[model samples]
Target: MSKIKLRPKSPVRLVATLTFLLISLQIASIIGQYLAHQFSIHRAIDVVERRISLDSAFLDVGNETLNTPANRYAIERYLERLEKVLEEKNLPVVVSEIQGVRTKSDLTEFPRLHRTTFENAEQTISISINSRNPLNEVGISWLSIILALLISPLFAFTSKKRRAQSAREEIVLPPKPRLVINLQEKTISNGIDDKVVTLQNKPLCFYTALVKYCIDNPNESLPPHKDVPHELMALANKCFGRLIELGHTKRKRPDFNANLDKTLSEIRAALDDVFTGYIDEKETYYPPRAQGEGSRSKQHSYALPSIKEDDIEIIGN
Candidate 1:
């Protein structure tokens, strides 16, 4: 019997897991540091408050009506003793900003810790605990961790949704070919597929004129038979005149209105030849055909509705 080995399919999952774990560990480390610093400060504050409440001088000061020099000296001596006791317990904090008498230890420049206010009938003595280490101060580390935790899952959800949407999408098809007409070369082409068809002088001029009219008046359609518009006729004559100027044809411009139907048929045949494999695109480039048993009196329009004005490029026009 042969053993079959199973391997993981995508490295993306593994990378994502590793990245998440790394971020979580970093956040946890920051939270742990902040908590540890808070616990130490709390312990130090508890010790100082307990010692202050037991002092006989602080109790006596509560009943005093005046904050005399002797009372201030007594409060100052009590704070010095409290500081010494905190130092013995390995707490790096000192009391400062008392009412009157200054202490030998001045830690005014350090980060202040929370302390209780001692108030008498005459004066209030509010002491501030200044810690030597800056890390004892409250910082934005906890706030940053909370924001990261909140935003990480949101980012992950959005990325997951995008991937699922992309997976459900179908393969995109190639863009349709543009219709290109070159009067200089007397050739019509499907710009994308390299399919080219050359037309005779009259048919080419008539087709170019029709394309130009469609570009200017996209919503309007020309009538079938010899009911060609005057503007269209003038444009056709202009194209024929350009051909004569270029020496492509020596014959004079023919009457476009008289030979309208024949010229339309010729244009359709040339377009069909150019788009041989792409027969479905005939409606885009071909002249509109008569529909559903229509008589000569009925309004049978000739137009290229599917082709946008920007898609049809007429060179040497």
Candidate 2:
């Protein structure tokens, strides 16, 4: 029987997995803290309820005694003692309102945590705690820390496995195709193959001017708009003059500046014919296409970007 083998994960997949795990753990931690705080609030309310129920003297007091100002002050003092007890236990609760006895003016400013009422034939007492999510009341347990520590080693092991797999499956690509611009023949060729693309006088001059400009200014892209730069136009005119001197074209000097976009499209179409079915070579030799529909801004150079100046051999110029 053959042993089963699992494919190694990519770096992107590993990173995504780590990110998801971290986010999940953070959400779980927040939920746990919230639940712990809620439990503390309920526990504090229960303590208050038990103390009020156990106060026989207050419960047995007549309606007349409960209505008196002195009795009401004593009840407020007893409630303050209960607040101290809760604070000592790290609950941090506040007695905000008592129905028919006293009401806090700023009760609406604080969130209401709990409310309860105690009633008998003699009188009724209502209490409310208006403090919520007290600081330092909820804590992360040691168990959660231990769980995180135990899970970290698993993530490390998975990350190492992915890296090792990527190393094992690494691919080596062939060298980039070279471009050769022959000015004398007015031809462009991919040096890897015998395939050559011949161009007319004006198109050849425009293409060669752009290529030479790219070589000189390797870091800059041509303007995205229809307007050509003065330097590029000058370079194109110089190439056209050279072609005319070489007797390649009998026609007079053509306007290189007029209809510049149409000339760029013609140059790109010629390059496309030569590098057809070869996507990488086409990308290397072809002029940068427009980015989007009606978009004037160019993100890439108007000339060959992938081909380096060292790789391009310009002859007869």
Candidate 3:
């Protein structure tokens, strides 16, 4: 007889196997979305931080300190030190005339700055300030974006790992509470509180509500609704736009990953909500279902649909 061998999977192998599975199925693109999203945030932070600091310096660099040249010189000195640091790091730096006529004190601080931002594609640092005085904003742009870019991949990698683990766990789970109700199923959108239910046949009951208590009723339903895990949805939404950049299209049901994950999570949450609601109602009816105990736990209920009071009888009352 031919030997059929199944190798024991090591932790490394397990991770690798999941990675391979993801790649083979082209899930990398889905995951790559997080990287892109992180990059955007990093880039934005770099851009914004540098812009603010430089904008401030631009006001001060042309200081007309008069006899108070020391104060003016002190600020310029700070900026110069910053420039040297940037140069050492080989970050992008630019100085140009400020655009748009903006009023400011000519006393010594009206920098009125403008310049095209630049940085290495790999690093993506930009000119932090036009002047190297006061050093308030120096090199912050470079450091911010670089850190953002570096951390983005890690976040993306972590997200995929978590998703893989979650999928595996779900697979290992013994079949969940199968719905016995005739539910009115709904296709959950990517919102945080989107609700959906599926039964062997069909289920009953579908409802939509805002996901967060943080906002007014209308203010709720942020990309990551309450129906989905907040962290998961946040990470997903961060990458959501990037997935859209991956030639993803929006339909009644999104074909992309973040959207799909969000949808699935919300649907599950919705199902859980309905199931719990039903269980609460059914179980609350004392001696539930023909002098029998309730179909669910008297304490915490998981919300598996019941066959109705007249249907399946409890093994023991």
Best by TM-score: 1
- 2 or 3, greater by TM-score: 2
Q: lDDT tens string, model 2, 88-161?
A: 88764667655444533344434655778886555666777766644444455555555655565455434555
Q: List per-prediction Cα lDDT, in the order shown.
A: 0.71, 0.68, 0.34
Off by over 4 Å in 3: 1-82, 89-308, 312-317
Query: On residues 52-146, what C-alpha lDDT tens digit does candidate 1 reach at each position?
Result: 54564444343335434445667777777877887788775666635434567767544665556765445555556666564544344555556
* Steric clash pairs (candidate 2): none
Error in Å for residue 72 of model 2: 99
For each candidate, give its TM-score against the true structure: 0.56, 0.42, 0.17
Cα miss at 158, model 2 (Å)? 30
**Predicted structure 3, TM vs. truth:** 0.17
- The C-alpha stretches of model 2 lying farther than 4 A from their native spots are 1-176, 224-226, 295-306
Considering every candidate listed, which one attains the maximal lDDT? Answer: 1
